[model samples]
Target: MAHRHDDLAGHDPDADWSLPGWLYTDPEFFEVECARIIRPSWQIVCHESDVAAPGAWRTLAYLGENIVVLRGEDGVVRAFHNVCRHRAMRLVDGDSGCARKLVCPYHAWAYELDGRLTGVPMRRDYPALALEDNGLVPVEVEIWRGFVFVRLEDDGGPSVARMMAPYDHEIAPYRFEDMRRLSDVRCRERQVNWKNVGDNYSDNLHIPVAHDGLTRLFGKSYAIEAAGWVDRMSGQLVDRASDDPWERFYQRHLPPVPHLPAENQRLWLYYKLWPNMAFDIYADQIDFMQWLPLSPTTCLLREMTFALPDERREMKLVRYANWRINRTVNAEDTWLIERVQQGMASSSYAAGPIGRSEVCLRSFAAKVRDRIPEARLHRAPPPGWSRRVRAI
Candidate 1:
């Protein structure tokens, strides 16, 4: 019997590169995503280093729900719903800080670092209420390689280890344990949809035309290949052929570090998880971007962290240079996505064909439609499910 992947050989290369128009503009679809995708999937809350010491805490917004991540006196980090049990007042107001106890600003209902209700402003008023039962609701929190992830679903879908199993080997070399957060920049209230941002970053087929600065620095013939679950794109500097100049420059002013790749000097890897997270790894630093949907057309593209402690000064300088390169590239892509959104809103527009190079994007859309079966109610399962079930 032929394997499932073998069947992909006959898949049409001219197939449409578009998703349903309603996916980007429908309010009901966004609500369904919040329930099925955002809430159930593992989410990055903050880095473990951010809440290292006892009482250190950070507040984050998840699917419109306020969440607080805190390190207890025992040095264990945990996540809790930020709302107070009594009157639902927010316990922690600011971004992050060390606090001995989380005291509600409204009613002074205090909670311990472990999320236990330790004090009430007026215990005499509500004698019938049980403090033990009314403690802050705890969310599942896990720390993997210094990054903290939280899951809000009651079922506890998958462990962080399993969710990130795809890129474990690629990330091992980064030494995430030794890294520290250097900067964070958030783009809020953006008019583009969240999927638009994700679809922009998922593939680099347009990089040569979209990012002229980058294309000029690292030649336009950059190669893109997929390995396991991650996709890599790389390009080499044409001018840096001989090692004599680089060695001389390194000897004079820079510390020892490997020179760029011979064929592809600058290797820029962009990895996208199944749902909505992206990891953009450059030579010196890594960018963790999470695209969160606030509404159908408005979303938050948060730059959660830029971390690199190995070559702080050099990385900082190069980071800004790459940031400028990325800004230009993102602007071009976002413009196209916004245009697509507008076209989607138009009554005349319909689905269009995806190019041969856009297989990844097509695969991504298929996977999305597969996982959220409700989205593809018309299609039957592709052979594997029934065969595997019968084999079992």
Candidate 2:
């Protein structure tokens, strides 16, 4: 278990330690992570249903890329740079909408739904500009179980389907391909490194101590385990009544999801993928939480909720109750992570020992250090470290 960058690597292989605090606060460290870990990773962009028709499209602003995902006339979904091919003007505005053509607001340049340049304000003004050659620049795209995923820059690694194969059988029953969007992607900005949010998601030990509603619902049944690329957590709801009205109502009215097994009906499962994607699966709905880094100290959290079509009054009630309950959980996590960010930034702090049972957090930290070996340093490297040194 000796790592190439750290002299202390020879310590027991099972030893779990949190990443150094400098890694969280250093701007140089963030740049290294973006190049080594973020750029080449696959990102879940949108569900197919979000752009179900040829004219439907959605945009994602991540790291520094302005990407638009859309369905074409031939029924194929594609991704392209959101910039106009003419003069680099943004081709789309806002989060999502249906458009017959992607027209640039700056110069009136237009593109077909599939990104083929179709119209320019002055057609004969530039005869040298070839329409076919000047189509929008495409980004890599893959659809997994009807969910659209794109890589900002490809690194010839495994596809999302390949990486997710370990849990394919378990997730098959949910039939993500058949589910439809319950809401648009909700954006939440926070003053913390992206890893802080990710580390919080993989953390299980904090729940009983910090989330009162979750403690009342799941009690001591929560569990977490890690694989090389994903972490799984599950908790079965307690039969005992909860004092919280939302939790009680949810438990009482959670109608039998006929498609799921008996055990699954009462279970809440969460899966965190390598780098930045996480799925919160309930029998009633699936919620995705994806965190993307903006700077050394800021990140954006994008969330989307999906569910199978059901119009039953009880089912609707259950869905609303579920939102109310999880809203509390998310707020609790925000407070905890912001505090972690502030604490990690303090001169008094270095690194702390991770509790023995925090396996998921340990795995995530190990992966980070593995991806960017410099993350093993107790202090931030010299400025210009990213450009002056090669990590991998």
Candidate 3:
């Protein structure tokens, strides 16, 4: 990929913005991201309520590694590398379940809820091996406001609280702990790059253009501002903005949502932590999505949860309506991002400059560049070199 900071030279607001095309399409670069970026980041595994009882377990895959998070007999949640100590076979096959002990199907290597090796098939065969030392390797697990997060790396950075510092005040009032997981939808085998999807969510500039249905119903002309790990994008609902038959019909049926200050109404809040996690908070509910890159071009998007426990049935219905609106918006984004994937493969493309209005996107790209030192070098090793060889 070419490095030309001068591309945005005349565009003062976007002067320093540059994202190499290879970062989105190169398999080598994607591997590096999995190691340096994804592995060390705090990933949401499951909600605490999901594993409320002892022996309850949830299985997940992160950066090519299978993980199992379970509530132990002691009633504390713990995470383990989902592989068995016996023959390196996977211990948990299903997404989630409750079990007295996690038993590997291949060899029946049973482990206690705390990941202690309990029953190894034909235990007499390994007289020299110590069961205590050969138990399932534990991963770092933490719970914040009912959300369970797991860190794979031994030297992972700050806690989830520190990482979410920017939106602490805004999210506190939501009383996330009181909310329950109502529904979840996982879209697997996505054919677009994970970063492309994340980039689309980070900026709401396309909402007015790509999401006509949304903008038409809930006015546009929104403002987008970035503050560390969070970004605020808000618009106003034009009073009696439309008299179209369809708009008027729905307006008469639906109760009015309390309007914010003209400047604050019709807001779309998109909060992202580095690597691949997004927590989008709307007025009625929250949408938590994570981008799991399976390869350079294929990714898995999991709409982990949508909770609105406190809202009335009518309000919940409205929240569901808003969720559908978001679904429409996401479908529009996926259409364009997939097209970009095809365009990225062309030799004619090299790089692109961020738009002045895309301040959040520019900030995201800057963070990516900052964490990815390889972006500074003309030729560098693949992204996962550190993980593959255990040397940076």
Candidate 4:
């Protein structure tokens, strides 16, 4: 591919065309993205609190690669490609656990929490095998605030902290490290391109028309702001309470989160991190979502919610109400994006102009172009293009 920003400079934001529809449904393009974009990007693995103690470990699959993040005996959190050195077999199976040593189920090769190959089942048979040279390969790991992120590629871009520095103060008040995850990671499969899901998340223009419940709650105050590679969409809850019994009851009875300011008590904030992560903050809770692509036209919306533990009866009820409300919002988003995906597959549909509120979408698409230059094509790439660009 051409150098970064080479193909993207020609894009005129005010009068530019959206990405060609076929890009959403092309297998070749998806393969390119897997190689050039997703593999090299930093992905949220889990909260720091998830692997809080030595021996605590978490496992996940990213872009078809299995990854393991664990807390070592020295109290350092480390990540590794979840492949046993002995036979290229999987090292970890489930989501998380607390284990002193990771024992490969295939051959019983045990590795220490720090990824050192401690025991080879048949030590005498392989006398030439050097223990010093054989160990689980490490993945780059970083912790920002409370979230843990791992870079799969050895030579990826800047650290997550540097990329996120601009919003440090804004995110500090949440004390993400102090908050605990409220549930297990929940995922829902949707029939839409991952980029389409990202485009939908970055778009504030559709809030009024597509998200009726949100419109009723926040009115027309939704606004989008950009800083570096991050975008924030914010709106204040309408002062006039809703007529719906659940909404009214929660607003009237549930107390605002004590740590947040009076103004923030009624704010809805969504921060879009480039590529595929979003942190959505509400008055009383925080939700992180990852748009993990399963194929060209399918994705898994992996989501998790977090908050300071509360024992109040009314607050529990309010949290349940909030959960119900988010379900409605997500359902609305699913319906809208799936329809858009269906339209993209149709022969009659073509690229459309973006509105002002969708400037973030344009910027995101530009980032995609920077990573995969051939995204402008309305059909599959030339036979050699993917291999050629991937070599770069």
Candidate 5:
């Protein structure tokens, strides 16, 4: 049977159609998504504090590309391929650390923090090699509100600043630049496509039924709006007691966060930067999460929370409450999304209609389709088909 991909061409932004089932289950389509939609896009890796000091480095494997974010002696942050030029051995084995220079573990080839090939075991062994050209491949790096973002390919799309301009004034209240890391990075792998997680994140209709903790906190008052490529969700925190005892106690005794303006005192603001990253801002702290596709049917979820340096007892209680409620919400979401993945793989499944409340999800799918037309396929394209496409 023919697929619905024909509808992707010049589709209306408000159309109710969802992406086809094959996009989530096909391995070939997944790779196309990585190259077309993810690789060329700016992806948030970690906060600037991750590589705050000279010589500090953070490494990540993203869509088959191994990347290292490092701070050089000049106090500038740079990103590079994690492979050594010679023999292509991985230069770093750990997730993060500090070192004067990066040394290849296999052949002892070394490079400066800025990615210059400064040492090769025996200096005179390679007379034909050009040291400058042999340095690690550089990736585009940008820092916005203390979040470090790296683009694997130079697609010349909008810079991080341009992408975030609409929300700059709104986010200034958080003083993200001054905020320090408040929790160790938490990473969990899930048996679902990354897009499945993104679909759940942009869907507000499931909040009441899927996320009980969030429903208790927001009282069905959450509102989501999309501007340019940024989607913002704001919910007014309720003052009433909750059905759960701890949740009730949390609402009644929520500690004061004076750093946030009085109007923002009881508001939870969530911002989704298209394709992969999401920032969640609450009264006392801000956290960001990213979904990395490990395979066609698996993804890695990474999250980190940040806050102003506050050591008061009341603030500590508030942080603890936030953590407790957040865990409950995440668990609920995980359960729902995992089932959605299973459903996508079913033979009876078909593209469904988007709801009025799912405009953000529609917009996300639109952006993906606009960039990679192959993603609109309702069934997997034939083998070696992507190589024949004129454009992704």
Candidate 6:
């Protein structure tokens, strides 16, 4: 059904919309978001322990940028653009590896683990070539609770630690720093806008209607709220049996985690940072993902799971059961997102109303409009609109 733009956006008390439909479908708006929102936002690359040893490295590719998170000889974790300064050739390939020095495969230019230029082949041929000033360009890095986060450009926003300070004390007992990686990093592509993924994750209104297993586990205890820069969500697993085999297995086999507080032993937490960093903290494991914008209507999902070492047989079974349960939730979400994306593309649809009490959705919309006011428009601004605004 068709809805008037102004009435949906302002006049009708029944309708409060998030980003307009065109915003999700516009290539120009996507470009602006990548430059204005994604570059400055912190992205989780890998856990610090992933690059624990000297010279260990992991590569992250996101929204046209490639990054390398390396541990230097001095045992410090640092991040830098993945391109060689000599010819912009990629130095490291694949997900992760160890190297004594970053040597370019193209020209044999070498850099120290700390990103200082060390060797260049045929040094005398280019007498004016200054190795001292040509190391890999650095990216800002932050390690919070064992996660390594990097941003292409410093936006002067709060560090990851400061941004999540509200929940630090409560989550401290989880001891994430001691957790070990449990699975290899995985990635997949989705044919929907990146914001669709975030919006679905933070929207608790869909749980009872969308995820029955989650409702079975958490009952009515699943809660959501917006906390400044983060959208916080959690559900306390009810101490009861489930008819679903997977959920039942988890409910029966999941043992008490001695390290976590009694209340958190069965709690599952979800936190979405300002842009697209999502932390899914569970009693069995913590799984984090970066929903990166790949194109106007497609996004990349990269994630890995981590947890404390537990060799017990049932604990292993519990983790597997948990995976299966969430796997279904993800598949269901994919179906829902594709339907919405298709519906929004229709000639008639303009925007959908977001309720006022929907704190997470409201918070997300406000943040987008705050950074990119063009998002407030009912349609995509004309070409050169940004320049016109700048001139004014």
TM for every model, in the order presented, reads 0.82, 0.93, 0.84, 0.93, 0.93, 0.95
Tens digit per residue, CA lDDT, model 3, 65-139: 999999999999999999988778988787888999988999888899998888876889988879999889999
Measured on C-alpha atoms, candidate 1 has an lDDT of: 0.67
Task: Compare the candidates by TM-score and give the number of the best one.
Answer: 6
Worst ten in a row by lDDT for model 6: 1-10
**lDDT (0-100) at residue 215 of candidate 4?**
77
Off by over 4 Å in 5: 1-14, 381-383, 390-392
Off by over 4 Å in 3: 1-15, 154-156, 235-267, 376-392
lDDT of each: 0.67, 0.86, 0.71, 0.81, 0.82, 0.86
lDDT of 6 by residue, 64-159 (tens): 789999999999999999999988999999999999999999999999999999898888898778888899999999999998999888877788
TM-score, prediction 1: 0.82
Q: What's each prediction's clash count? A: 4, 0, 2, 0, 0, 0
C-alpha root-mean-square deviation, candidate 2: 3.9
Name the regions of candidate 4 deviating beyond 4 angstroms. Answer: 1-15, 154-156, 378-384, 388-392
Candidate 2 lDDT over residue span 162-183, tens digit each: 8788789989899899999998
**lDDT tens digits by residue: candidate 4, 1-392:** 00111123354442266787878887888887877788888899899899999999988796889899999999899999999988899988889989889999998988998889989978889978888788999998989888899988844566778767777787777778898999999978889999999988978778878887777777777778656677788877776788766666656766767887777887888988878899998767899999988999999988899988888888788888888877888889888999999999988766777554466776777777667667765555567777786598
lDDT of 5 by residue, 1-392 (tens): 00112132255743577897878888888888888888888888778888989999988787878899999999999999999999999988778999998999998988998899988878798898889999999988999888899999877678887877878888888899988889777889999999999888877778777778778878867887666677778888888788876677667776777666787888889888867889999877898899998999999998888988888887778778888888888888898989999999987876787765566777787888787776566666788788788455
What TM-score does candidate 5 get on C-alpha atoms?
A: 0.93
Residue 33 miss distance in model 3 (angstroms): 1.4
Better candidate by TM-score, 3 or 6: 6
lDDT of 1 at 353: 59
Off by over 4 Å in 1: 1-17, 154-157, 220-265, 310-315, 377-392
Pairs of residues at least 3 apart in sequence or in different chains that clash in candidate 2: none
Tens-place lDDT digits, model 1, residues 47-87? 88888899999877868798899999998999999999988
Model 6: residues >4 Å from true position, as ranges?
Answer: 1-15
